[model samples]
Target: MVKYFSNDVDIRTTWDLVVSAFWQRYPNPFSGHVLTEDVVFREVTADQRLLSRRLLTKTNRMPRWAEFLFPANLSRSVYIVEDSIVNLVTKSLTTYTWNLNHTTLMSVKERCVFQESEGRPSLTRLRREAWISSGVYGFSRPIQEFGLARFKSNQVKAMKGLEFALSNLQGLRLTVAERRHGVSPASKTQ
Candidate 1:
């Protein structure tokens, strides 16, 4: 069985900021489960589009009831591959990600698109979609359902991480501007 999920949200930030935040979103408090990320490839196209591929390692703890089904040597970490395209002309970023391990039990593929909001120029629209499937015959239905639920929970944390990164980026810019003006950070409080 296969299950699908989709969601759309508008973030009160410009598309450029959103794109910048995405590149720095890791190591945030909300994403402790994400262990590491490495850029495997990146290139700028003739059309001024940026393409990138990254590999990520994340913790994947199984539920207590499901623990007995897997082999003892199975690693607690899962590998994920993400591919992204950034179109400077259109002010859009699109990414596709999928897990590289544990496919026999469950597989999840996700795609996200970030674009400038049509109604509000200062806002960015994020559209996310996911597909989950399992090959286990009798357990496919339950496994797919569990995958969908977990995906939803992880997405909440992902958004929080993004927000944290955006705030940090803005704060850094503010500090740089203040320093250039010869204004101390302490002076702002006074």
Candidate 2:
């Protein structure tokens, strides 16, 4: 299955700590992009029922204030972030497993397809086909190197944002390469 490393930390408590630290103000400036409101806040279980009411009163299609306040359950942790460049919506979820050590793992799965009102098919058909054909492999060497380099460059600033939440938690060790299993039949002949 999916391979992930364990970190010695309490997943839930760490998550709460991190959220509280970063969500006080909107991370990115709302310049050029259309924002309905000036500020947003973190949502907890207590704010679930008020979501529809808030939505009804807001002028923006989806207000950032209400968006962040939505309750995250086991299935869906976060909703799609507002992006002005693309017309599609994107969302992400993260899960933690408590075992020998508390392991915090995150997977980002995104779709950029919009549904048709008349019940037409989605635009992800091409992406799905390419994925099935194994066209998209693991991250490229350049991509990996760039990611690590960026992380290193911003380590101090990044940690400042996450330290409170992750103070007791250790980062999960990540594999540099993606593991592949079962060779293609065509390669067997070679």
Candidate 3:
């Protein structure tokens, strides 16, 4: 089992190794790269419109072209334009094709433990101090029994790797498929 942690907080533990492996295989796209003015300043509305039309006309098993037509609400025009450039670059540089794997990782959460210590009381204040220490000790036993220590340790490890990847991959971008306006007859309606 692998663990992930961020900012001293545990995120996930089990199956984290799988996630890390996937990340290593498919590194983030936007990593320490800058977009030139030519790339960012170029006109895209016309191209987007053209692409949208092509997307509507091209009907195939994979409806990826439709991404240009009805982009996700969160999609940015700049990223889309950049993606178009990347696509062109890939086509031109046949020897250096881009390999991006768009996959999601699953995470699970479980309860964990925390501990704190209190100072021992003087003999003169034995009654009050005894109850305090006893209560604290009682809670610690349950926390340890729950295997929270193990969970926390794993969580920390997983998150550290995730954060490292995210930070290093400077140009990481996520693309979501857009939905077409018309629904197919076979599709269920809301």
Candidate 4:
């Protein structure tokens, strides 16, 4: 069994700042399960596009229903691999992430796109798509259903985490254009 999830939101910020925030979002209060993040690869293309690969560690996030399937001694930390590309010319950023660990029980694949809002320049349109499945388990189909249900619940909390990061960005008194430059107005003075 396979399940899907989606989200649409308007972030009152430019793509640059949104992309920057994406790289810095894991440490927020709403995402306490996220333990560490590391950039495994990054490069700027000749056309000024940015490509990056990152690995993230999430701790103590296994769902209660699925804990018994996995061994008690199995490390609580799960690793996720993310790859993203920023199209500078089009003012958009797209990303894909999937579990690098715990592949046997379940796998969740997610995609996110940030684009300059056509109707509102000050806002960026964010879209998310996710697919989940459970394979190789004794009760694979039922496990997938259980995993999907939990994933949908987690998605809300995760979006709130991103929103929290945006609120943090907004708290620093950054102007619309200031966000594009990757700095708040007050930070420029020092």
TM-score of 1: 0.97
Give lDDT for model 1.
0.95
Return the lDDT, model 3, position 160: 53
Q: Could you give the candidate ranking by lDDT, starting with the highest? A: 1, 4, 2, 3
Per-model TM values vs. the true structure: 0.97, 0.23, 0.19, 0.82
State each model's CA lDDT, in order: 0.95, 0.25, 0.25, 0.81
RMSD score of candidate 2 (Å)? 23.7
Lowest-sum lDDT 10-residue window in model 3? 123-132
Put down candidate 4 lDDT per residue, 1-190, tens digits, no spaces: 6778887988887777777777667777778778888999999999999999999888746667667667888887889998999998898999999998777777889998899999787899989898888776567777777767767767777878877777777665457667888877779899
lDDT for 40 in candidate 3 is: 24
Candidate 3 collision pairs: 3-154, 3-158, 4-155, 4-158, 4-159, 5-159, 30-171, 30-172, 31-171
| lDDT per residue as tens, model 3, 42-65 | 233533321111000111121343
For model 4, the local distance difference test gives 0.81
The alpha-carbon root-mean-square deviation between model 4 and the true structure, to one decimal in Å, is 4.8
Give the C-alpha miss distance for residue 113 in model 4, angstroms.
0.7
| Candidate 4, poorest ten consecutive residues by summed lDDT | 168-177
The top-ranked prediction according to TM-score is 1
In model 1, what lDDT does residue 91 have?
Answer: 89
Query: lDDT score of model 2?
Result: 0.25
The model with the greatest lDDT is 1
Roughly what TM-score does model 3 have, to 2 decimal places?
A: 0.19
Model 1 bad stretches (over 4 Å): none
